[model samples]
Target: MERNFLRRLITAPVAVALVLGLAACGGSASDPGTPGANALSGSDQESTDKYTTEKVIPLEEVDPAQLDLITEGTLRVGTLSDAPPNIFIDETGKFTGFDNELLRAIGKKLDLEVEFASTDFSSLLAQVQNKQFDVGSSSISTTDSRRENIGFTNGYDFGYMAVVTKTDAEIKGFDDIGDGKRIGVVQGTVQDDYATNTLGIEPVRFYDYNTVYSNVRNGQIDAWVAPSQQAEGQVKKGDETVIAESVINTQNFTAYAVNSGNKELLDALNSGLDAVVEDGTWNELVKEWYPEREVPKDWAPGSQAVKLP
Candidate 1:
């Protein structure tokens, strides 16, 4: 996985262009009528207050034997290899990013080993529910619909939604998104749900960030609705793409996904998360990875027992 991601990062320019060209020729945009394409609605969302306010179980009370982990003392995590700064593979082929590193810290608190595997964002949640991985560390937003299938730890991060477009394009901001524009989004993402349900438009769904952002740069798509941190990472100098607009949605806090049946693992993670937050590891990682974006005063990670420094 590390070698594959390294190769992809090294050959991104050539590979992205080829992928965009092929996608354009084959009409890869998802049909709105298709199941899971534009299927999300307001009903999918639920208040996260329960997760935010729930008292974390004491760390000592967490029994690893009851956690039903894939491995006895290791957390086999599922994450993306493309979305940067939060959950991507670095140039050295190391899975060291904000989300993964934060999870590592939590594992340390729990006296567990943290291991990561790269997978598509589309299948990550389902894979976690199926116990393919002990946790999903892809900056997943916890929603009511998603909760039906899998469980989530208390939030460790917040995020912003962004729209990326060519510098010369007419789409300047979020409001500029309307009918008759070719908008791209990662499949099975909150951005996909927003573009489909809120904007009332059919979106071109790509499996990974590289492909969607590639289409934006190549003019094959007018805009890409993406996570702000990832958009900033991808839209580098002279890339011909810019993050035209970004809006913070504090309602949906980003958390680690776990299997629904694993209550012990969920409670254990929440305890570990509170530990990190209380010790200031969470704040440090936020400052390190998200230097450009400030943490909103109204928001903080972990349970109410822990506060950001």
Candidate 2:
């Protein structure tokens, strides 16, 4: 009788476990539901709560890289070498820009060696997604779409775009900006999307921002619609022909986007970002590069790819 009673208890527990196991198998949170970053297809994850940002989350407990710190010194960072004052190269063949300096500051806090791998801004998303680098330092924009794949740090540079041209240019607003104007865009970027869709203009695309700038400055094209920060660099560095007008596309936000799965790296990046913002590092970078305008929030490539604010 005692044995039978114990067996009944065991059978009941086993039945419950089997039921719960089946439920878990059916509803596991990690299940890839749809396309786009382990999401459920045909399901609108727009309501997914994962996008809700925790501004000051700590990276120590969360980031996986710390757990596997094989190198102990290097934190490979990805950046766009074209966005001046944010991430760009100097005439001396040195990487000297806004994001360049800020990311170095982050490296100091983490006690890690920093290496910059420069590529097209569009690749920032894909490379970070693939773990090509530890963090993305290019001034990336944050949006619902980008959050789907890569995590984002708090905003760094926030500004608008400018209508730059050789003539005392007549490209006043978004509408006329593309009207009969041969617009230029960096290849494989949200800028290309904006040029093709919103601006209603066919973009004279280049492989990188420098080419876009080169083509615009040499008067090979009428104007170049680039980030205000990039345009600011050109203006400060003496691009006489290009003029930045207060067009809508010119004024947008940007941020440093990182791949999402690496919670440790994301946390560290955000923590470093918080430190930077607190010690006035963020604002100082703003003042150093853009002393002329008010810096807003942030922008990311592939971030919703919405019209520039």
Candidate 3:
């Protein structure tokens, strides 16, 4: 009878422990229905929080007089709607790229909200000049002709004009692209000017980069000329095209453009650019967008020569 009583005590405790263990496992604090639970891992949460934070710049510390904002506290920016690596709308409907991120950083420093206006590349400068936009943030190259109508900030990037052709095209280099061959270029761009004025070729014009790529892929055009980075991006997508050679080897730097009369706004943009460069924000953006390309250490807007790393 004593032995039986001891066995009962041991078995009862064992059964009770197993029941509690199963109950605890069924309703853990880390489970899906737990209150205040997070589904994302720790690293994902950090990354999400980094980009989703609304308030990056301390507004209270910024001087309102310096901003000279167009709409009280908003910076009106004009950019291309489809140019990738510079400014473009993604599949997820998010505005992102090197230029977009840089503008966002500039807005943060000035304690202003950025309102982006999408338009064609050809119209960016004219819109800025007409005061339709406070600034143009497209990958607008700084040239003497543009300076006559718009004030350019210090150049933030240098780009080369490249020629791209089909992988099996007989064109091996710029020299092989004869005058009789049909070439495609974005209208009102340096490439267009080169084809018409410099190369003495009557080139076909397209408004958007995708159209140019499609035309070349479908044999609608023999070759296309655009910025080296833009051409490289298309090539990197595993398309049936390749960057044949750089036609314009000169240093063409790109910068933000403002109305010629808006000195105050220009000064504010320069100040913001200085802040981003000094605080490593510019480097972070460059690393993110142009991971394979090198940004010069002493590079500032309008700096003449940029050697890629």
Candidate number achieving the greatest lDDT relative to the actual structure: 1
lDDT of 2 by residue, 191-279 (tens): 45455544445779787777877787787877776655676676644566655453222122356666677666666666666666656
Best by TM-score: 1
Overall lDDT per candidate, in order of appearance: 0.73, 0.53, 0.61
Off by over 4 Å in 1: 1-48
List clash counts for every candidate, in order: 0, 24, 5
Return whichever of 1 and 3 wins on TM-score: 1
Q: List the residue pairs that clash in candidate 1.
A: none
Order of candidates by TM-score, top first?
1, 3, 2
The TM-score values for the models, in the order shown, are 0.83, 0.70, 0.74
Residues 238-265, candidate 1, lDDT per residue (tens digit)?
8978888765543456899988899889
Name the 10 consecutive residues with the lowest summed lDDT in model 1. 17-26
Enumerate residue pairs that collide in model 3: 154-301, 154-302, 155-301, 155-302, 294-309
Candidate 3 residue-wise lDDT, 1-309, digit = tens:
000101111111100000001100001112233322221112111111111112123334457556556777888888776778888888988777798889899888887788997878777778888888888887766655556577877656654556789989876654565466889988777667555554556779888888997898889999997766677666655678888765322233467888889877776666677667667888788889888865433334422221222
Winner of 1 and 3 under lDDT: 1
